[model samples]
Target: MTLTGHSLIAGEAVAGTEGRAFGINPSTNEQLEPAYGLVSTEQLRAATAAAADAFKPFSSLEPVRHARFLETIADNIEAIGDELIERASAETGLGAERLRGERARTTGQLRLFADVVRRGDFRGVRIDPALPDRTPLPRADIRLRQIPLGPVAVFGASNFPLAFSVAGGDTASAFAAGCPVIVKAHNAHPGTSELVGQAISRAVRDLELHPGVFSLVYGAGTSIGQELVADPAIKAVGFTGSRAGGTALMRTAAARPEPIPVYAEMSSINPVYVLPGAVRGDADALARQYVASVTGSSGQLCTSPGLLFVPAGEDGDRLADAVARALTGQAGQTMLTEGIASAWQQGFRSVESAAEVELLARGQAGTTANAPAPAIFSSNLDVFTGNRVLHEEIFGAASLIVRYKNVEDLAEATDLLEGQLTASVQATEEDYASAAALIPVLERKVGRIIINGWPTGVEVGHAMVHGGPYPATSAPSTTSVGTLAIHRFLRPVSYQNFPQELLPAPLQDANPWQVNRLVDGEAEIQPR
Candidate 1:
């Protein structure tokens, strides 16, 4: 596939008539060729209009057909092969091996949603058959099923270009939910976005689906993203980026005449609490794993453990020493972008200048413009509580270790944290009582809590939740990963006294889809 520097708008390779932007190689600090033209207001309107026009037919398609379409998209993405991986690596500075794994994760998520569609569980079909033969007040013949919430605007993420970009989970779940999607390509990886966008367009065409079923737009700044969110034709949005960007979209979506749901995955520190027993048992091994998680992907993941809580004593000192020793051999790595590198530097400076924070260790500095030196900082509970800036996300390979005097101090530190995508406890059986006490506090503070595990790698599955309350994401009830994410683009509609012909197949008495559904308050699996 050729890298056309054109936006895939309404199934056509429409050239953006606005200003142009080029993909920058973060590792080399060099601009990539074939400048991508930014989309104009008119083009944005046209794309949304096309998606709105396509929504009816797209959403009304049979469940089986929807499943097939999703599978086709997965196939098309895989067909892109090495070209996709190479472009993504060059554009974002992510290694080919990592890109290949991300590509598999992207396709795997698409196929998982396909299976979700085939199973028909996302429909949320429920039936309460009317009892006309009953008392004076007979129950009305009512059935409920989830319907698509029309067109969705997806924002490509800077990190994980393939897995979180144009054809990533947000788009996949939206498409699986039968909603038309218009993705705003991330500026950092325009070439990768173009390739994946073209692949999706090809799948839409090969399936003979609506041309407007998918579209990709490019922009140099926030104008296009804000306009896309404010468009009345867009019913919901999916975003993965910084807190400022996500909150800006949330405000825009909320201020619109007809407000829409914005599932914006924003910031997360993903705190890890190291219980005293666990820290005492094998601090060296724990330190090794902790350093690995923080340095993985240059600490670009949302679930990266940015803050670690440990008991202040011999155990804590041992852990800190182990981390310092581990940091000596670690080397600086190239981040996803120069802007991110700058932000990391600023965040590191903030931590370094804090009154009680101590710079425990520093890795070898990188020789390139976008490379960042990994650093570990330590502070006591008093200093951390007094300084809110210490809690902010650095967005790079930097973490802070907060030493607590006791379990109460640990709980206090945990309470001070903002909402996070995940919180982990490195504990053993002996620490269960202490770990159990922290679970309640963590439950309210984060979405997922892991025991004796790292929080960096997020698995896309049925029960996985890549979301949390408040700053972690715009909407806590919905997720941007896994099959449940389909609900973000869906709204339940109850059909009252509708004839079989007028009702959806899953809601009809025939139960054509043969899906498990609630009937009169009981779970039932009806035959086709």
Candidate 2:
């Protein structure tokens, strides 16, 4: 199927003059289409400047109106569901079924942000009333609410092209907070991004949003990215990619005269632990479940279980055998891009070269460019503890099995883990008792802890935590999932000593416009 390609700037399809860049099909190693032009540095500057200007009026819009705009965008995304899936599959080499699910995630996220805006959750508004008659001194009445941070620079992620690209959570959350967006399209699937950009552009027109509210730019190399993040107009950045890529952008943001927040979720191993009782009772069952985790989406996820900790014994060996057998006949899967495939191959080789580990099952390398085979390895706790190299993430269908001599060794291993998005435990009652001492340490190391379950299926709910320290994400306290994600796009401001007539409608006297807030000394919306 033919796909159209263009950049959306100021609600129009603006073509770039730079040389073309090609998007290839990973499944067949075929060229999917002719190259598209990279957005010139001039275009990048213009897009950011436009967004900066757009933020002035957009951020001041009434909360209800902004919420309506978000609702409209969500509807528009849902209306074009089929087109998004088809283009995303064709452009990114993902299967149609997988793309369909991603489309839902993408639109669902947009709608979730709409709910957040309507509920004023991101506002986080608080009021502290004056006590003029109190002792000490007359206290001042102060009202506080979150304000939009301004224009945002979003770097699209390669995986989940539909959900993490142009119209993904980062862009959606920014818009929901009333900040304009300048998206740097991912090179792996520019065609899919263009289609989504068009839909967003339509939403902007239908909602009568500012022309410069959103802009799409395509950058082929380091120069475009550097320019995007370094610009002063960009109040913040959102990125999901390799550690190296995220770090580079963070450094750029830091070096700027006025530094901005960079929300970058680089990589994680998403480790899992299996206690002695569980390994002894049903090592085979646990191994089968884990095999599915390592091979899910060919293990091309940030939450993929890269490390497995097990008690060393006859049972542990039996579980290792089970895992080896399960992985033995598994077929390879299509990776997101050639760069990722190459990186996965290199990362796998690095683990195999480690003196601390032993390879249990070696997956066959693919003859084609996109396919990634499954790989499994085994090692002792001492070896892994002594070597920091064993802790890094390998972004592919691979798992490293670590055998601990005792519960103490398991505790030590848990203590050594860096911050992660999720950690799982496979434990029976006896095993749970044995590892109960380590739960606190594990809790500190990851955002979420699971029992007898995989970590890849992240639920998009109010309680979900998708961020962790350092490598997992630059901002550990903030999530890139759920309505809370909008917090990244806002900062709190307090208004004091202002007349009722001068105050914003949300905080005006007589309880006009009936929204929830602390009025006078009480929490009520009734008329004064």
Clashing pairs for model 1 are none
TM-score of each: 0.98, 0.95
Give the worst 10-residue stretch by lDDT in candidate 1: 519-528
Q: Which stretches of candidate 2 lie over 4 Å from their true place?
A: 1-3, 364-368, 510-514, 518-528
Candidate 1 global TM-score = 0.98
What's the true lDDT of residue 165 in model 1?
A: 83
RMSD of each: 1.2, 2.3
Q: Residues 1-528, candidate 1: write the lDDT tens digits.
A: 888899999899988998899999999989998899999999999999999999999988877888888888889889988998889888888889999999999999999998888778788888899999878788899999999999999999999798888989999999998999999999999999998888899889988899999999999547999999999999999999999999999899999999999899999999999887888877788899999999888889898899998888887999999999998888888899989999999999988998989999988877766887899999888988889999899898999998888886677777878889999999989989998898999998888999999998888999998899889998888788888899998889999999899888888777877777999989886444
Most lDDT-accurate candidate: 1
lDDT on C-alpha atoms for all candidate structures: 0.90, 0.81
